[model samples]
Each structure stands twice: as structure tokens, then as C-alpha cells.
Target: MQPDNSQPKTKPKIASSTTDPVDFDHAIGPDTSTPDGRREIRRATAASAMGNMTEWFDYGVYAVAVTYISFHFFPTEGGTLMALGTFALSFLVRPIGGLVWGPLGDKLGRKHVLALTIVMMSLSTFLIGVLPTFEQVGILAPVLLVLLRMVQGFSTGGEYGGAATFMAEYAPDKKRGFLGSFLEFGTLGGFALGTAVMLLLQVGLGDEAMMAWGWRVPFMLALPMGLIGWYLRNKLEDTPVFQELEERGEVQQHSSLASLIRGYWRPMLVMSGLVIALNVVNYTLLSYMPTYLEGQLELDPQASLMVILIGEVAMMAVIPFAGSLSDKVGRKPLWIGSLVGLFVLALPLFWLMGRSFPLAILGFAILGLLYIPQLATITATFPAMFPSHVRFAGFAVTYNVATAIFGGTAAIVNEGVIDASGFLLFPAVYMMAACLIGLLATRYMPETAGASLRGTAVPDAHDTGILADADA
Candidate 1:
């Protein structure tokens, strides 16, 4: 079939709520203007954000405490590197988790999967706190630690995709970007909170006490956090979009895998490609910055945690502004600007980070600012790439696969690159490369700001059912 010339290139028209047979926003709770609506929105937002908080809190503690974990979990020689390696190990199974949980999310409902993931993550994280040390358990200690991390990775694979989908579907279209920012806020908030807790503990307890038992306290905190997230999620209704699909009898009976494979290859590739930059920046700054500061630059461990804590707090403040701005200008503009900014500034930031405390904080803060556009808008952007039926699976599989390969291994890869080449700032080079890939991917995506969650179907020759379901 020849391509139709009737469709608009830049802005694709999608089915609006008024014209659609079903109201996607119904049963999502009270109106946005009413008291009940405001309370429901707050509860829904917390439900979504807390899951992100739980996942990142564990990650933040692990990354910040890698040095201590290294001494206790692995051999003395290269123990830190091994600890970092263990950190990366958990991500290896994320794709598998995505495959299992993503389709289940699409098949069942986003709320149930989210509740399950929190439980899995919380149990694994809490168990790590009580695990025997290398001195006490011999080789079994590291083995058990790796096993627990694998479980964490598996659960997290499903957590983020579902959270983003649920939040976007529940939000008002005009304010999706603004409200979506809360999810990322929870992300940075969790990391900042975890880092702050560790920093205070380190300051008060001293290294010896922290290494002995203080670290376990933070890990143990995951139990209560996860329980709160689970309760919030259980109290909420399923997303308006998913509910609408079900009501309209448009919910797919086939597996999300089949639907994705049959029609969503391009979007899957594009989403994965964009994630390259987003996650490399995420893991690099959020996950690896402390390691780089303390291990490579030889900054004080407590000071390094403090720098990251401050940077994350700053990033959290700016994320909603960036997300709200994207709603006005377009998701593509912010993404393009940030990719270019990171490409240009990655090297300079690293250079400044090596200088002194003030410059290091300044450098990290700048990098975090540049990174905000991507992190802030991702929840608003990626879920819009696919139709409601396969949104969870499509986002989960592609995001986790790319994250597993690039994001999870960022620290290890940077360490190896610098080690082999004798260049300290190779991470800057890596970040730039990832940004370039993301830039290319973003250009191909339709401008989706304020677009319907169920996209506008173009009566064109190139219409693939699933892709058209996502609209432009």
C-alpha cells in the first residue's frame, strides 16, 4: 500500500475524550476541582511516587555504601570493585522480570503488579541487612548477597514501568507533565533521603560503627517504606485509561508480547534508544557519582555523600518546573536541549568535580540540572509511546533491556574504561555517546505533549494497529 499524503507530519490528530466512545477519565475518582478530587489526586500521586521512592532508596544506600559493603561482603583486594560489580549484577535479570511482569501488568491491572513488586523489593532489601558477613559465612556471603540483589532487580523491573503508566493514565492531560514530575520528585526525594540518612549516620557513628551495624538500620527501613507503598497502591483505583479500555471491550486478549512484536518494533527501538542517555545520566550521577568522588577523586566519603545529597535535593526542586515547561513547549525541545547540554558539559563537569569541594558541588549541581529535563519528562513521555493495552509491557521490556545493558553497568564500564585507558574522565565520553543516540531517537518521535493517552488514529496507509492506538 502506498503511503497516504493526507496525514500531518509534525502533529498527528488523535481521538479526543469528547469524541471518543468511552470516557477515559471516568471512575478515576472525584473531579480535579472538588475536595474529594484533590484528595484522590494527592493519594494517587503518593501511591505512584512511593513505589519509585522505595526502589531508589535501596539503590541510593547501596551506591553510597558500596565502600563499606565491599569490605564486608567481598575479599580485601579489589573489594570495592567487586561490590560495585555486585551492584551491577542485580540489573542483569531486569529484562527477564520485564518480560514476565510487563505482560502480566497488561493482562491483569497496573495496581496489583505494583503492589507485588514493592513486596518483593522490600523483602530482598530487608534481608540484605541481616545477611552474614564474609568473615562469618565464607564464600556463601557474597553468593547470598548476589542472589538477593537479583530478586531486587527482578521486582524493580516491573515497579517503574507500572508506576509511570498508572500515573500518566490517572493524570489530567493538560497537567500530565506537571503532575508526572511528582513521580521523579519521589525518585530524587528517595535518593536524597537515603543519602542524608547515611551521611548523618556516618557523621555520628564514625566509620567503624557504621561498618559494624549502623548500615543495617537504613536497609531495615525498607520494610516499613514498602508496606506504606503497598497500602497506598491497594487503596487506589486502576488508571482511567486502562479502565476505559476494559469498559469499551478494547482490552487485548492476546499476550502483550504478541501485540508488541506484531506492531511495535519501531517504538520499542526508539524508547530503548532514548533510554540510553536518560539512564546513563541517571545511574552515572545518581548511582555512580558517590563512587567516582570518593574512589577516584579521593574526596571524603561523608563529603561525597553530602555533595550527592545536595545535588539530588536541587534536582528535585527543578524537576516539576522542567516537566511543567515541557507541557507548554513540547517534550522534544527539553529532551533535545538536555542531550546537547550534557554532551557539551559532561567533560567540563568531570573536570570541575576533580578540583575541590565547592567546585565539585557546583559541578554536580549543574550536571543534575542539565539532566532534569529527561528524568522529569520520562514518566510523561514514554508511556504515551504505546497503546493502553501494551503500554506497560512495551515500556517495561524496552526500558529495562536498555537499562540493564547501559544503566546498570555504567559504573563498571566507566571504571574499566578509565582503568584500561589511564584516563580518569572516560565517563564524560560515555555520557556524550549515549546523548547522541538519544538525540537521534527523539527526533523521530512525534511531539506528544498534551496528546491523548489513546492516540489519534490517522487514516493512512502506514497505520499499524498498535502504533496507531498510541496515536502521535
Candidate 2:
């Protein structure tokens, strides 16, 4: 069923108190069936997407080029672990970034916070390109590198949540899933672009040059990409959802954290559980798979990157279709089915990937496809889990905390596990465990398909006149 767009006959009862039995029937709805709305959607998507692209590109280059980075920054002994450890260290501060930026986004507006984060993240990434190596600077090289990574982690905590919230608020209700997929598309596309560039540089410059100077090019490129994202975002108005709350003098009556803890804890926990599964699969495939293939499976480095590139492109192409499909069938069914499929296929797929290059590509492609349901629906589903007043904070804090724990550490944990036990299939087992936890949490979430973002969490509470209750 399509979402209701008609205005309510009367001003709807606002939820003034955390305990108030208020409805969100008329809280906020989609903008534009007109040319202007479509134009704004395009503009909003580009602005949000550009920064996200840069973020993932940095991640891709770092993950794909971990060996070179390790050799340059850290000492020869334990350097690979240190390099990957630095990679993981960046994630440790994500929750701090979330805490600092989330409420500010709620109070000051999403666009400005977005603008600030992009600049910070871009600068940090760009500077990494110029930092002196251990041979030149001794112990200071890795220290500076770790500091920059901390800044990158801090900025990104706010970036992902704000981008998702901004896009979801701008999107049409019935089409939210379809439109929101663009964010993740940018995510995959950015990673693919980064990987492609690294591959080209390696082929063109040879291993020595690539390790010495060529690897820096992708990090340097972040500056221009960030500038583009900033310009696009600066031109746009805040979302109508946020704008309305601002105009009504209710934008931030209390801190987003306070409001979230007082009233929105349930959705926050459920969303975090879902994030654990999403990020584990996401980080494993996009950021850690190349390492796995080369270090453990003994595939050629270039060949592993090629398989990842192919899988990323394949996944990027399918995200929108998955998002659109969820609009018709609902979020829970697709999520449930996808988790089940992953649980059943993960170990076998990991085994298949070890057999041959062609088999690895096919294995990664199938896993990427299975991941689409969650990725495509995230922006559409997670934002709706909280009210506009605390949506950014709720999503940011919970999502980042979960990612910090499960997603960021996935590579390190899998590597450690395999190193200790010599089990090549450890990542599959880890992912399977995450999938089980996710399925249990997903079972209790409201279906939320075609459900109004303005509606209250209570089932069948129709005061908003915008939604009707649906099953999970």
C-alpha cells in the first residue's frame, strides 16, 4: 500500500511528554510530486552521496593497500598486525564522534554538521598522503598515522548517521526504500572506485613505486571529492521534517541523547543488533576480503582485488532493486530471508572461494547479493525507528557503537582466530554467529513497511492518520 500524503483535517496531537500517548499521523511527510521535489531529491542525494563515496574510498584504499602502509609506517616486526591494528584503532573513537556530533546535528541542523564532518574527514585522509615514512621519521611516522586515523574515525561517526537521516527525510514515503538505496550505492561505488584506482596504480607504477608514492594518490584525491560534497550540501535547505520542527520552536527542547534514552531505547537496541550483522558482512567483504584471499587463500593480490571489484559492482547494481522490492513486500520478510540464506551458505561459500579465482568471484558475488536487502533498507528503516527530535542521535550512537565493536574488529578478530587455530573458514563462522543474533532481534521489530515515519511505535495507534498497523 502507498503511504498517505493527504493532510490531516485537524492539527494532530503532538507527543509533548515522553509518557504522552501522542500520534505522529501528521508529523511529517514526503515533499514533491513536482519538478522541484525531484530536483531537490537529486541534489540531496548527490551531496550525501559524494561525502559517503569519499569515506568508503579512503577505507578501500587503506584496506586494499594495508601491506604497503604497514611497511612504511610501522617497524618490520609485527607491522602487519600493527597496520591493521591502526585500521581498527580508528574505529575505537567512533562512538565519541557520534556522541559529539549526533546531538549537534539534531540541534544545529544536519547540513552544517555534514559540512563540518566532510572537511575533517577529507583533511585527515589527504594529510596521510604526505606523512613521512618510518625510514625518514623513525617512531613518529606511525604515531602521526594513528592520530590522523583517530580524526577520520571521529568524523565518520557523524557522517553515516547524518547522511542516512538527511536522505530519508528528503525521500517520498512509499519510495523511501528505493531512493535511500543511493546512499549505499555511493558507498559501494566509492569503494569500487578506490579499489580500481589502486589496481591501476599498481599496474602502471609497479610494486616499488606504488608502495613508495603511488598509494598516496587516492588519499590526495579525497580533497577535491570532499570539496564537491561540501558545495552541494551548502546549497540545499535542511529537510522539511527538520525544518518544520524548527519553525514550530520545537527543534531541540532537550538534548537528543536525553530524549533518546528517555523514550527511544527499544528501537535503539534493536537497530544496534541489526547493525552488528550488516557491518560484519559489509566490512568483511568490502574491507577485509582482499586480505583474506591473499594472506590465507594464497590467491594473487591483484586477482583478489579483481574479485572484490566485480562483486562490489554487482552489489551496487542490485541495491536499488532490493530497496524497491522491500516497498512492496515489507522490510522484515526480506531481512529474515537474507539472514537465513547467509547462515546456510556462508561456510560453503567460504570453502568455494578457496578453490579457484573464478569460484572466489562467484562466491563473493553471491554473498554481496545476499547482503543487499539489509543495505538497501537501512536508511529507510533505521531512521523511522526514532522520532525526528532524536533520530540522528539514536541512529548514530547505536549504529556506530555496534560497528565499532563488530564491524571494525571483524578483520582483526578473524585474522587472529585463523592465526591461532589455522582455520581458513573462521570468517564464515563469525558471520554466521552475527546472523543468528540479528535474526533474533529482527523478529520483534515492527514490519514498518509503508508505515509512516510520523507514527508512534504502538501497534494500530492511528492518531496520525498516516499509517495502519502491520505485522513484523
lDDT of predicted model 2 = 0.83
Q: Clashing pairs in model 2?
A: 25-464
lDDT of 1 by residue, 267-363 (tens): 8888888998899989999999898898889999988987998899999989999999987777888999999999999999999999999999999
RMSD of each: 5.1, 3.5
TM-score on alpha carbons, each prediction: 0.91, 0.92
Clashes of each: 2, 1
lDDT of 2 by residue, 53-87 (tens): 98888999899988889889976876877888888
Judged by lDDT, which candidate is best? 1
Model 2: CA > 4 A from native: 1-31, 256-259, 454-472
Candidate 1 pairs with clashing backbones: 14-456, 455-471
Count of clashing pairs, candidate 2: 1
